[model samples]
Target: MGSIFGTDGIRGIYGDDKVNEDMAFRLGKAFVQFLKRSSDHPEVIVGRDTRISGERLQKEMARGIIVGGGRAFISPIITTPGLSYLVHANRADGGVMITASHNPPQYNGFKFFNSGGEKLSRSEETVLENLLSDTDPDRGLKIREEAVYLKEATESYVRFLLSTIPKDMDFRGIFIILDCANGATSSVASELFSRLNIVHGLINCAGDGENINRGCGALYPDSLKEYVLHLKAVAGFSFDGDGDRVVAVDERGDVIDGDQILIIASRLLKERGILKNNLVVSTIMSNMGLMDALRDMGLRHIECDVGDRNVYETMKAHGAVLGGEESGHIIFREHHVTGDGLLTSLQILFAMKYFNLPLSKMSKWMVPFPRVMLNVGVKKRPEINSVAAIRKVIEDAKKDLLNKGRVLVRYSGTEPVCRVMVEGKDRKRIDAWANKIADVIRLNLN
Candidate 1:
């Protein structure tokens, strides 16, 4: 009964009260109703990741769309970005992607996109939320007819990806590992890499509908590090369940986070004169090292809030072409409206090709300061500034760190947890401070 939409989307364990088939149907109908204001007969593109609940939910949503006097086209298995592309390419009214991104397999959700392939803005989401609440579940019987499936969606997406990279650019000698996380990118990645003639191996590519993000992918890039070393590959890329984010592993089995990826891509784009405004936008969660590296390269840097949507909005305001989060959501504004993992991977590879350097070398520009992050489960989410004890501890830690480091205390938008991040020149000091803050939060909130 709480607000269904989170920072990303509506997410919870499948079959739960909120994420059940009934909610899916209602959401579909609500979305169509919202779209009808612009178009009399609205059309929607629907896609899902490889979760067991996806097909059932898709059918329910299709039924709702039909009953709502709209047309539905289903791209049964596709990445979030792929669905975004198809929405714009086909000129649909809107689109819906059924996924939970990097959340565990049991979690599933809906991500809405407008006609321009951008995630629904906060104001648009609010409209949809109002519609969702007003939808009547018993307004119509379920329609047995399912949404029309787009069989060519995957192929078209691959071709579009190829168009992003130069046709003459050679990828023959680059051996890389791809961890699909057994999600939406499993078969799509195989086909794309094969077409490009890139020598690559895949891990966690076989999804039984239950293994997506199960001990693999961006959430666990270290899981792919050994495979990179064993294959003697130049680098490895691990994508989240829905393929909107990615984390890279270098040849030395070191994890190259989004900060490092942004640094590498920004430098290449700047040299090519494609970096508009010579600016980069990252989230507050980004390492200080990334900001320092940008300064050293004489590139303007800005910090936004924690979400990728916030980063993109900030990028738009500043006319910056590159923006991302430390959690691996990198948006190359020149290529697409939202984050695309495959496109980002290609950008990284393009950077490698442009510099004639290996990822291990390119990733060395930023030396992250010693940092510690602790997540504390909470029974309630109270304002951090409102809690006197918690506020006092955070203020005390800030004073102690002084000019050397900083402390950030915030709640996870998608989960019921408080995250405490402390960074400083001294690791031990930061670690102790982080623990102190986390313990205080737990005492007050739990």
Candidate 2:
């Protein structure tokens, strides 16, 4: 009954309250009930990442949908964005993706998308929550039908992604590397690059379910960086568990985060005269340098809250085609409604080819200010401003930066942690300051 959905969706350790089979089943019935308000026998697309629990959750949800008089089309082992695309492409009423994204293997959840392939707005989520509170998992336990399985789901997504790139662009002789995070993309990334004639190596592409995001992926780009340098490849990319985020590595082995990727892609779009309004949308979590870089290029920058959904909504409101978070949730609105890690990589590749430059050269436009982030585990989340000790430390850290740096304190929407970020010219100072803020949060919240 209580709102279980976090910033993204209902996420927690699998088998825990709110993420178990019963919740997934009830949520599915609720989703069906909500969709039936507009259409009878609403069709829903269901997909999941490589988590071991994904299959179980998908089956339970499908069972609920069947009993609720809804049609469920289940895709085999697909990424979150892939599922979103299918929802839009298939013209389904809506979709659900079983994933916890970058969270560890034990964590799993669902991301729901509307028919337009956008994440559900807060109001829509509320409708589902209310419906969930009313629905009983066992009340309509008779399954009338089995969910339909789409065997070509991954193939459809791959084909659509390939189509987004230019037809004539040559990728021959481009040696690249990919770290699939042993997650959703593991099954499709290699096939994608191979079709494009890209000479590539894949690491962490084998998922045993438990190995997804175990130590590789966008969350740990160092492994990809090392592989990129060791192979002397032109570039590399690391994707998160759900394949909605990416962290790139260049030939020089320098990690290119979402901010740099945004700068690079924005410049390319501007050069191609396709950048609408000359505007880029980024979250407040973006680096100060990214803002400066955008200004230097005479592009407009709008900062939103810390979520890709927030960035996308702001982008849509302003007619902006480019937006993302610094953590690698870049949304190329012109191509898709949601962020796709594989799509982003291709866009970056397109940028490189369009400019006739290597990944390192294409990414050198921005010099990120030194930023340090510390995450403190918390038992509960109160508004940061309402906590005097935490608020005072955050304000003092900002003041100490002398208008040159900034401090941001926020709780992780997906996890039980408080994130303290401090950025400035002085790395050591910001690092120490971030730790101080994190310590205060720990003392007060923990």
Compute the lDDT of residue 141 as modeled in candidate 2: 65
Total residue pair clashes for candidate 2: 0
Alpha-carbon runs more than 4 Å astray in model 1: 139-146
Where model 2 places Cα greater than 4 Å from the true spot, the runs are none
Q: State the weakest 10-residue window (summed lDDT) of model 1.
A: 138-147
TM-score, candidate 1, is: 0.98
| RMSD of every prediction | 1.2, 1.2
Tens-digit lDDT string for candidate 2 (265-363): 999999999999999999999999999999999999999998888989999999999999899999989899988999999999988888899988877
TM-score of each: 0.98, 0.98
Per-candidate clashes, comma-separated: 0, 0
Candidate 1, residue 14: the lDDT equals 94
